[model samples]
Target: MIGRLNHVAIAVPDLNSAMAMYRETLGADVAEPFDQPEHGVTVVFITLPNTKIELIHPLGDDSPINNFLAKNPDGGIHHMCYEVGDIIAARDQLIANGARVLGNGEPKIGAHGKPVLFLHPKDFNGTLIELEQV
Candidate 1:
């Protein structure tokens, strides 16, 4: 029940450096940093021909991205987001299939202002998977 690849999220310790690298060095079309308090992250999207790359940085000490950066100082891929036609249906299907959904198994408003849910990393080959309603 997943559609196209929505975006690949990468956790970075330094948001400014990352943005400069993507915009100046790589010459990519990057969006301005958006502070998502609910998600506890300041994010920017690097646009691509087919998909987008989400650069995420911790918004506070309690942010999940802070923990991720602590584990990997250099920072790396945090999650991969895939689009779904219907988030609720997709969530039910994943649950019925014995897949573990993260964070109370409810959909949250994502960066795109779309419904989004995260599945357990272990269930998806050690990679965090985010399902976003298209």
Candidate 2:
């Protein structure tokens, strides 16, 4: 069951500049940056009462986030992640509803080490939807 608003992912070309803007201009308290070697992203997190705001940049050549940023280049919402109590159930629902999972199966570790899985944008009215269980 999806539970909460996990976070909104924003892919930017420059991580430092994005973090600075979110902290200085938006008055959001930036958290310690971390690298998800698997996804090839270095991310900074900003916690809100419900959902968090994630600023992400590529850390390597094969970075998924890098490809996303390159394609979009707007540094806007990359995906909307909703916290789920049961990722399996949530994914099942999508599958039954004719949605395809981005990967083979199971949720993978996303930013902040949260377990997450993505529904293909093609299946979700062109919106990349993520379900995460923290």
Error of 2 at 122 (Å): 1.5
Task: Please report, as a residue range, the 10-residue window in candidate 1 with the lowest summed lDDT.
Answer: 60-69
Please report how far candidate 1 places residue 128 from its true position, in Å.
Answer: 0.2
lDDT of 2 by residue, 27-69 (tens): 9888978987888888888988767888888888998876777
C-alpha lDDT of all candidate models, in order: 0.94, 0.82
CA lDDT for candidate 2? 0.82
Task: Name the best candidate (by lDDT).
Answer: 1
* Cα-based lDDT at residue 4, candidate 1: 99
lDDT (tens digit, per residue) of candidate 1 on 97-128: 99999999889999999999999999999999
* Cα RMSD to the true fold for all candidates: 0.8, 1.5
* Residue pairs with backbone overlap in model 1: none
Error of 2 at 128 (Å): 0.9
